[model samples]
Target chain A: MSFHDREFKKPDFNRISDVIWEVPTSFKQGMRVPAQVFTTKKLLGEMDAHVFDQITNVATLPGIVRAAMCMPDGHSGYGFPIGGVAAMDIENGGVISPGGIGFDINCGMRLLRTDLTWKDVEPKLKQLVNLLYDRVPAGVGSAAFDDAAGFAKLSHGQFREMISSGAEWCVEKGYGWKEDLAVTEEEGNAEGADESRVSDKAVKRGLGQVGTLGSGNHYLEIQVVKKENIFDEEYAKKLGIFPGQVVVMFHCGSRGFGHQVATDYLQLFLSVMESKYGIKILDRELACAPFTSKEGQDYFAAMKCGINFSFANRQMIAHRIREAFAQIFGKDAEALGMRQIYDVAHNTAKLEEYEVDGKKKKLLIHRKGATRSLGPGNPNIPKAYRDIGQPVIIGGSMETGSYLLVGTKGAEEQTFGSTAHGAGRTMSRTRAIREIVGNTRDMPRDKARAIERRKVEELVINPMIKKGIYVKSVSYSGLAEEAGFAYKDIDEVIDATAKADISKPVVRLIPVGNVKG
Target chain B: MTMSYHFVEDVSLADVAFEASGKDLKELFESAGLAVTNTMVRNLASVHTKVTKTVDVEGSDVENLMFNFLQEFVFLKDAERLLFGKIKIDEISEIACKATLYGEKLDSKRHDLSVDVKAITYHMFRVERTREGWQAFVVLDV
Candidate 1:
């Protein structure tokens, strides 16, 4: 049934705590387990009805272990709502669905801390932003490296090695510092990546798109660690963040490569979902296969390749950002103290061991639009930051500020070590466009103005400019759509995250410059 | 034959969706292609035939064919940087179709690029024949 026609009662949420809400299994027919949602009472009221429907649909998937969970930033997505998290038991017919990982596989955030302060960069904001906008190829159909010239030089075997090696390959090629690898999630390489499983079309799409910042919420921002916003001063200092300290953050993914890999596998899963697996799904986007099956194994291998591609993609971009800083600040990247704090992937289905029912069990956890927030003493964290737990970068809209947080043990017990990814969208892109530009779908060609080139800036851009944040983008319409008003309030979302004890806020950053695609 | 298509509001806060219909499969495919193109560029009339590419895709069923057909345009846009203003489906069947696409390389100066559609999603994706015509609903990942 369509969403409009479907009948749903206000889900009976059992208040597990002040911030934790649970929809018991009785809420839906096919649900094998309950659904856990983390949000404040007010934020929960703000969610659309479809968010509950989509999360309940996820609860019905085969082999789900505990409950289908959503983070504070949860919103309706295609098959699975964004900010969804669920773990499946491999032995109990657990399945792998591309919808769980999202189209942009390994789409994630990376943060870099620098010794420079906001005062140092504010004077040259325009030049620095323009330089970054130029150096990093962005927007639709933008490619930084020409594939024919670059990949053509490498033999097929060498290209395979690069894909298999992930960020290490980029480091070996001198794209990043060797130390950067340790701070990256999974050490920048996911195991079991077999390039042979990756389709040629996916490979072709990936060739030259490395280091490109893609459109639609993907961006690079120069931010300042605001002293007044720091909630945990000791922890913030331990992370090398301080008042007025300058930092860089960017959000991106595997680009066309990841999209194609997800597309290829979704098609395969759809073709066999009923015949080989005997599984039924509520939505076509939820197509999946048993995790141990050949189809699932193949997708996992190819998905690893996508994950590797993303790691390499961010590594390359990090190198570029460093160069841009060095060029503008008149100091080498090292002397500028531009070191990586951590990198985390929001869209991924990883096989990990977690304790369930006081027994350690292997589960394939799918986190879409959610970040892994592993608590302190987790051996997986880099040795340097193990005492403070993994750093979770929660990016806000260009106009709102972002936050740096630390994982909590409570999250590991409550939600598979996952937390909110960002300030989720509150309005659809069409609605955002309609708000900025008058109706043009029915207008004549001559009457249709280029909203991107319109001289009059929207109300959103004005405030950002007044705040001394320089914004550069390929399209003003795109910029308007991503305005802070279009998304949930970052402060409220983080407040829910902290109150829920999934993650604790360390520092808040105000944007000084933003480069949008 | 009359062909029609219109953008529809999806529940997704980040993506876009559309509904397209035509008298038959050929017209339906063409209308869907146009709808997808319109999401990227501001004005379809402004895009000229500076480049032409043939897209040949095959699938096991009509639904798969629609998925592949729409995905081909996304691939072409990123791989070759071409944005088609016009699409002509020369051949079509339940399993396969061959089409010619006409457009120009994406130019920021000339083309007002809107949403960057990352990929086509199968969320609520449908292709069916009604008494009035063939209709399809598509959700795009932006």
Candidate 2:
């Protein structure tokens, strides 16, 4: 049978609330707990069938606490749904799975607050975007592109140190401001990262890609915060967001290095999982080892390196962005008030303390394509905005706007401090391409695919331009695949999160210019 | 059928998936390798062969071998900044495979590139001997 023909148990969801749905353990034989999904009824219906099967499969894993939860943006991913969040009891036979994280470890969102408004930026927007595009390497084949040589040049030893210390090393190298680390998750440095656990192949792959923004839905956008979009004036002011303020938001991660690290451990775990641990998973991508085992500990150490590498990667890119803005505005970045509001990672497995059954417990929380939404008063949050809560940046498509949100107490009590990441894909890339270029098979190989380019420019790019959003992309075909219509409505997703009380929406920032990978 | 590979639709929500078939294991590996390169480049024929490199990989089984073989190209694209126009299998087996890859270092001005594939994921990844020949299914995380 083909892949789609493979049998998967359909979940019979019981409505726990208007937004919360549960699939009891009886739905799957191996399930250790029920599976839960947080989404509106309409969005839950729109979710792919594979999401139910995948999240239920996650519930079967060892030491899964409470339930295997999927956020509103959940979609069918390899082992867990993309917006999947699961916590494991480490004192038990809890396991660490690379699939639970992702190939691009710590792939995340970063927002920089600038004092300039749209009025100040509109005239120089094109010049600024082109310069930023030139400074930051993006899209496929960027590692080999000669232009990127001017962006970041690090020696082997220095590269190693950067991965070990994350953005701290970058600040020391004068890549960013000292205050920037305070708003970054984990202070932009993950503890227990051992470089020895990373392979030479991984190091080589990651060395040149440090500051580059690799492709596939990764982007850097210049957004404007209109006054009407800001929900809470006090919170917005606290976060340095003002009416008509121009900001820079980018989403990226550790490039090839993280992929290689995850690939290495996934293969290693597959070799020993069934043989050594006697753990049988529903999918090979869910290959895992017990938390306390040598293999698990080694993978965790290596994974931290991936996390740190991404932190440093974003830092360097932020530095470049600051430089570009400084050059364009004819002022220092600090003088332009380019202070970073926050940087939050979505793809990660963090060990955090949460209350369970009125007792404080430390659990290894695996958030793949899910953000950590720490509630107000949580000590983990930065002191400056601790009363407002941890900042959650949810990136939408280039055509639609992105959002600034804050964590809520409801998230801590209900979902283990997790929320949706973005407006998840409702359409495949092939489908998106077909909508633009028609069937590839029907056209001759040497036709130059001029029609494809024209269609993308007309259907995707032109529409965004009509909306006054300037876009610069490396490939028209790549741009077409990321058209806003391919994703679920961002407004609906934010509403779901708000209704669930997991995250409180602060403001919606519309893109004025975008550099898509 | 003369066509060796085709992109599979609807199998993955956000990534690319494809199927390839060949009369033998050598041809199977070649067809799959070409599919990988095709996924990244708008037109496979546009890539002119200039540089040749030999790649060798080993795995526990046929499926793992296919995964490792394809991952080598991804590694090359990132580490060495090479993109392949063509792939020829020098040797193949259930556990190990060796191949010669022909392509030039990436030139942004000359080549029309698409998404950067992160890795070859094991999700729904399969390789099997069919009635006609050998067939393999692969999902690429872009």
Per-residue alpha-carbon lDDT of model 1 for A407-477, expressed as tens digits? 98888888999999999988888777777675776777655664433522746677788987889888767
Could you tell me which residue pairs clash in candidate 2? none
Best by TM-score: 2
Q: Which regions of candidate 1 are displaced past 4 Å? A: A1-9, A145-159, A444-447, A450-456
TM-score of each: 0.96, 0.98
DockQ of predictions, in order shown: 0.69, 0.75
Number of the top lDDT candidate: 2
Q: What digit string (tens of lDDT, one per residue) describes model 2 on residues A25-100?
A: 9998899999999999999999999999999999999988999999999888888889999999888999999999
What RMSD value applies to candidate 2?
A: 1.5
Query: Which 10 consecutive positions of candidate 1 chain B have the poorest summed lDDT?
Result: B4-13
CA RMSD for every model? 2.1, 1.5
